[model samples]
Target: MKNRSNQQKKSDRSTSQGTSNIALMALSAVPLLMVLGNSMLIPEFPKIKSALDINQFQVGLLITLFSTAAGLSIPILGFLSDKYGRKIIIVPSVLVYGLGGIISGLGATLLDDSYLIILIGRVVQGIGAAGTAPIVMAMVGDLYKSNDRSEAMGVIEAANGIGKVISPVLGSAVALISWRALFFSYAILAIPISLGVFFLTQEPTHQGQKEKLSSYLKKILQIFREKGPSLLISLFAGMAVLFILFGVLSHVSDILEKEYNLKGLTKGLIIAIPILFMSSFSYLTGRYLKQKGKFFKIAIITGLTIVGSALFFLPFLKKPYIYVGILTIMGLGSGFVLTSVNTLVTSSTTSEQRAG
Candidate 1:
């Protein structure tokens, strides 16, 4: 009788631990999908630009559309999720994201210019994405204690790296067949992920009762004012710079051919080299963060590395190898900075605020 009772207790304990691990893993998926959706589009941009006959400026706008929408929507949805619940916001967002993917694919097929339609689809994607990534990070903060939270965030970032690593190759393969297919593929990816999230994940409750919108906004403003306004400003500025870099890199093949006389596969490989390094280093950084919780040091190092790389590029502006080296350093620096910043942000806020 005693042996049987002990065995059952052990089994229950194991089951509880297993459940907790799965929950953490699921939280990681939110960021993973967010990054995957964006990264996949990178390799396909050439095909998209050529098919739509869009200018560089127009191509840049497509990225801007997605990011701007995401930025506007994240805080709003985060606040709503804090008031209502994460699952309520998340499930609908996933569905909208899938719809956006379908619309993007259809727009690519049906529209004469297609750029406008694609832009609309990207905007929808951004809106839907707002609820998932940030909310998931907030949820992790709610679920885990401080020490564990950093590791959880690192795991989430690692998952994102996995998605980013796969996206380029997968997108290239899909684009080779049909550019429209890439968007449809994203829709397919979203459906199963959404279903899983809807059925499996539980919405975390705030520790305290919800605050008024005005109050919440006031608190957010206070946090920015008190904790790290200058740091936050610098981070946002860095993000904008990175976005511009990504936009330019997306058109590297054209630049290489137009300016340097590089041709075909070589141009493709050159562009890809930096991305490969970035993905690899991002994964490594995530792993490092999981083991060590030196957020400020990582952030500072990342910033310095980026500044140094940018300076290095100025000296060898025309050399392809120098560009590649700079990009690799930039990627490593970005990975370190992003992971550190995310950890800091999540830690700074309460669970409710994080959700907000």
Candidate 2:
């Protein structure tokens, strides 16, 4: 009888773990898709500018507008998710994102003057993006406990890194067919991911639904007051790392094509090098942090130092191998910093206020 009980318990544990893996995978897709909304378009930017007869500044607005929209909407979406549920908000948001992509593709393909239409579509996609990766981070916090949450956070960051590595190459390849095709690809890819997230993941119970909005706001404010310094610093580190990574990538893409005569898939493959390093380091750092939570401050400091050193040396290194080597080091630093920040931010709060 004891043996039978033990066997059943073991079986249940295995089943539960398997289910958790599936759910994590589904959640990871949200960040990957959200990333694709922007990074995948980087390689296509010059082509887009020329096709639409727009200036560099005008073309740049595509990314700026999307980012601005997503940034503005995130807090509101987080509040809604806290009130209702993560999955409910996520499902419709993904659908909206895909719809936005479709509109952009149609306008670009069928219209003579389509820049305005495309910009509108990008705004819509950005709003959808606001509900994606951030909510997934909060949901993961709600679902897991202790080291498991940290590990899951790492996995999510790694997924975002992987998306970055993939986007450039994928964008260039698709652009070989038609740049408009890239827009439609967003919709094509989002559908399955959205469905997977809806069905595969389960949200843990949240107390925010019963709490008054005013009380919830007060609680969040209190959390900020208590952890304000550390949280702000962590947030800043995350923002700086991402800004550097993306800014470097955009510049590299342009120069690789203009100066090095490396365009299309060749340019993209080169762009992927730094991102690949970043992704690998992110996965490793996440695992390490899970095991050694006490080293959070050290990891953050070390990452920042490495990134700073790399940037300082960048101006003098014009040789291809040397330049790429520096970028690779920077990528490693970014991966470490971002994984630590993400884990810290998500695990700091309780389920009730996590999404908010």
Candidate 3:
């Protein structure tokens, strides 16, 4: 009976994909790769700092530069992708992303001033990173009609969480062989994935009148004024949630190794549990919202409250297991917030403003 039930479940799970869905799945790799490029580096910080002959503060700039570049470039790139086409921006962005990785790997290999060169490469990666993730999100809006958009967004968010889950383990394993290999591996993986997305996916149709820069700027301002506090709240809340998420994850390795005497694969496995909660919950939330299609505002508020509650009590914890338990709770809120709010943003404007 158990065997029959297992077989039945397997049969039920099997579903087919069209060329577009296939392409969308491949496109999902951009965020996964984008995340892996950074998150994987968490465990490698000591190695990088030592090899580059840099201090902790200078070493920290590697993350800051990539994030700074991505943040600065996203709005501009979103506008361009909207103006031009998703494919044009995405293809080139992937190429630039690979080039940046290659350059970073080479700098670490051949140069004395590896720090400066790798920093430049990371900045370049950030520039490329800026273009890809948002374009992919915009592509989701472009590719799927409104009914299917939420599911697509959920899958992408789950992919992002999965990448975070995998990065530490993958990074740790690869570091066993060579820490520099992780840099090159992203370049190697990116080329083919980008190409697959390019060839398989059809470009989303752009219609109607094109606006001048002045007109577009005015329209964007108009959107801001109309959306007002709602948009502002979403933006700030997204930032704050992630600030807690990454900020906590950033310190995990040190705490686990120093406090608990854990390292390597064991450490990586331990670090991944909360993130796994995030991904699984994100997938479920996406499905839930896709069907129920209500409580979006409520869910977002609830998610924020849950995250706040988790952070408030964290200072009193002693056991590593309890600490991780709270982090998992934080992940639950993050997953909820990610699914609902992202769908809101993607659904906010269906046409020209969707990408912008």
Candidate 4:
């Protein structure tokens, strides 16, 4: 990282125009859409169950299927994106995502027990998701000069935060019209964003080969071996941060609706409060990396500690403000963890190695 930092400093001296902020705004939509789509679905789960005549177990699979498919496909897509270019992979992925959404939307509109078709749509969307956010991470690193890199990365992270903050509200608003419209919204988003990436983003300069599938898998293992044990720790830490945030949110929306007797826009607004803090702090962390990067290890440790402590106290809270305050507090730590881990990975590799 020090070496990369020094290199970035040298590169920063050159006034490379690189990717414009406009282009970045376009890329920012990817993550914002991802989180927004998922969080919005959380509120829609029960509604979807009723509309589709599915049981609780099947309703659960709406989220589960999407995640499982995305998780499984990312590694493979990572390799393909490396072999090809980010543009080539991303355009198709976005289109596939739109197709999935359309399928789900049509299924919901046309049939009552269209659960099977909707499930298929989610699976397709998940497969497309495999290429969306992960590839964007690699592209952000490729598109910026080192000095601008942190800020660029920050903006994307900020967009992610913004998504979290607004998703519930947006989702609630959209669902008011028809829950089926929610699926169409995914299609609506994917099309323009895909076109933006295709036309606006430049093909990055890199030295990676289009490896044979056999060799690609072998190289992935080799990367693990070369980086040694600390990589595992980093991976685990990043995993835990996302795991905690998503796991809590998965139940939080329902709990608020059922236990606290909150619903609709009010529920969404409440859910967004703490997440607003998380996004704000994530942007701040990225912008001030020159100072904070010096305390990377400290930031990671301190952030996790704050998260754990806040979450520990959440179970005892009785008021809405208390929940909001605790999550806001947790967001500070989450921002640190997310920004640090995201920067570590994005900055550490070239466009090619990032694919693995």
lDDT of 4 at 152: 88
Query: Which candidate leads in TM-score?
Result: 1
Off by over 4 Å in 3: 1-18, 49-60, 140-158, 204-209, 289-294, 344-350
Q: After superposition, how far is residue 245 of candidate 2 from its true place, in Å?
A: 1.6
Residue 122 displacement in candidate 3 (angstroms): 2.3
Worst 10 residues of 1 by lDDT: 263-272
* Alpha-carbon shift of residue 9 in model 3 (angstroms): 31
Q: Residue by residue across 97-188, what tens digits does model 2's lDDT show?
A: 99889989999999999999999999999999999998888888889998799889878987887798899899999999999999999899
Query: Candidate 2: TM-score?
Result: 0.81
What TM-score do all the candidates reach, one by one?
0.82, 0.81, 0.80, 0.80
User: Which TM-score value belongs to model 3?
Assistant: 0.80
Worst 10 residues of 2 by lDDT: 205-214
| C-alpha lDDT of candidate 2 relative to the true structure | 0.86
Residue 252 error for model 3, in Å?
1.5
lDDT-wise, the better of 2 and 3 is: 2
Tens-digit lDDT track of model 1 for 1-356: 99999999999989877877877776677777787667666656666778899877887777778888998898788888777777777778877887888888999898887878888998998898888887777677767788878788778767866776666666666766787897888788788777777766665554444677788778778778777775585567457545745765676545565678764445545656666666676567656776777665556566556845675564447677777776666666666666565556667777545546
- Which candidate model has the greater TM-score, 1 or 4? 1
| TM-score of decoy 4 | 0.80
Best candidate (score: lDDT)? 2
Considering TM-score, which of the candidate structures 1 and 2 is the better prediction for this target? 1
- Compare candidates 2 and 3 on TM-score and give the better one: 2
Clashes of each: 0, 0, 0, 0
